[model samples]
Target: MAETRVKSFVLRFLLAQPLTYWKLLKYIDVDIPTVQKTLKNLLRNKILEYKNNLFYLTSKGREEAKDLGISVFNSAMCPECHGKTVTLSPFKWLVKEFESLTFERPKAISEYDQGYVDSTDTVARVIFMYQLGDIEGKNIILLGDDDLTSLALLASGFPKQVTVLEIDQRILNFIEKKAALKGWNNLEVIRYDVREPLPDQFKGKYDVFLTDPVETIGGLRLFLSRCVEALKGEGSIGYFGLTHLEASRQKWWNIQKDILEMGFTITDIVRGFHTYLLERDDILNLELKVVKEAPVEIKIPEVDFYTSNLFRIYAVNSPQPLVRGKVDWQRELYYDQEAYVTCP
Candidate 1:
């Protein structure tokens, strides 16, 4: 059943033009392993062909697409906003400063599953939080700082305090050095892992929390449980990113159920709200199934095709954490069968 749906989606999308593996991953709403398997099946069946580092329909595939009634349509996104519904025009100055400050930022490493959104998207996230009254004078905590959202929040001159809890020593040192150079006394970086219990000082101390959690069910639960433990109480807010490339609809349903169980009422979910700028070098270094199994040698992607939906949830009641004191979940926390991009 899942294979049928993925085949239909791939055939319809390829009806318009040839696409690279990265573009297919961006457009398809299935898990990475599923997409890779489906593509291999299609090629074996002579329904698709690979050439010039792109995948397109074969003659038989076009006949199948016609039988499936697939038709091309124009995109309906706002050109100015790129479908984000918000722009950085209001904070152009901050965008320039953020660019300079992050010019020498550390490159993303696949070991920690680290990738960051574009500079505009980073500031746009800050703008969105500010509009929601979650920025100015709010005590906010970021479970991880690979995106350097902490810097954007501090640069906005909002937020009474911003704290970062990260496992990567490189990220911790980078953020701390930046904070000191800018004299951002309100910023704090803590070298902490998520598998452990939430620190006593941070529990119930923040008005808002943000994290881009790993997409596995266990990963999501652990990350959000920590965020829940950090909130001040009812009315506190949290933000995070979820992507279809890694998580399927069934997984999304389970995640939504977990959020409700944790006493969070989802306020808004903006689809494709964040676009990640994955470095080419970083991607080439990883062991991606799609690249390894492609019929033709896949070229490194030139476009920023990876994206995620941004979700905002409010703590309507006292937050309940599913995992209080963590048991050992080393590889399970980061890797699962659905995890195609993450290294084991």
Candidate 2:
């Protein structure tokens, strides 16, 4: 049943244009292994062909797409906002400053499953938070700081306090050094592993929480649970990024269910709102399984295609976390069947 849906999706997507593995992976809502298997089956049946590092439907595939009621058409999004549903024009200076400040920042390491959105996206996030009245004079807590969103928030000088809880020592050091250099008295950086108990000092101590969590059931629950622990009470807000590339519809349903159980009501979700910046070197070094097991040798990606939807949820009542105390998830926290990009 799932395989049939993936096949139909791939066929219809190809009707738009030929796409590379990276592009297909970015747009597909299924798991990596399933996608790879579908591609193999399509090729075996001569419904798809690989050429010049791009995959497109064959003659039979086109007929199959016609049978599936697929049509060729072009869809356009707001070019100015790039479908983020927010404009970055107002935050141009902030984006420039953020780019300079983070130019020499630490590189993303796979050990912590770390990656960050583009500098413009970072500032755009701040703009969105500000528009929502969650920024000015509000206590903000970031469950993870790989994106260095704390820096952008501090640069804006809107938040009363910004606290970063990260397990990465390098990130902690980088944020701490910059905060001291700029004399950001209200900014705090703490070395925290999410598996540990929520620190008493941080519990119920924030007005807003932000995180780009690992996209596994256990990881999502753990990350959001910790964020929920930080919120002061009802009306406190939370923002996080979720990706279709890593999470399927079923997984999304599970996550939404978990969020409701935590006493938070999801207010908004902007698809493709966050885009990660990955250099050629970053991709080559990450050792992704899709690249390793490609039917054809995958070329270096020419664009930043990895993206996620930004979710904004607010506590309707006193938030109730699903997990508490010290519980180690070990490999389960970082790698799952759907985690194709994560190194196993």
User: lDDT per prediction?
Assistant: 0.86, 0.87
Name the weakest run of 10 consecutive residues (lDDT summed) in model 2.
Answer: 278-287
For model 1, how does the per-residue alpha-carbon lDDT over 67-179 read when each residue is reduced to its tens digit? Answer: 98876534567888777677788889989878877888888877778888888898888888988888999999999989999999988899999999998888889888888
Q: Which stretches of candidate 2 lie over 4 Å from their true place?
A: 1-5, 282-287, 293-295
lDDT (10s digit) by residue, model 2, range 160-222: 999999999999999988889888899988999999999999999999999999999889999
Choose the strongest candidate by lDDT: 2
TM-scores of the models, in the order given: 0.93, 0.93
What's model 2's TM-score? 0.93
Error of 2 at 111 (Å): 2.6
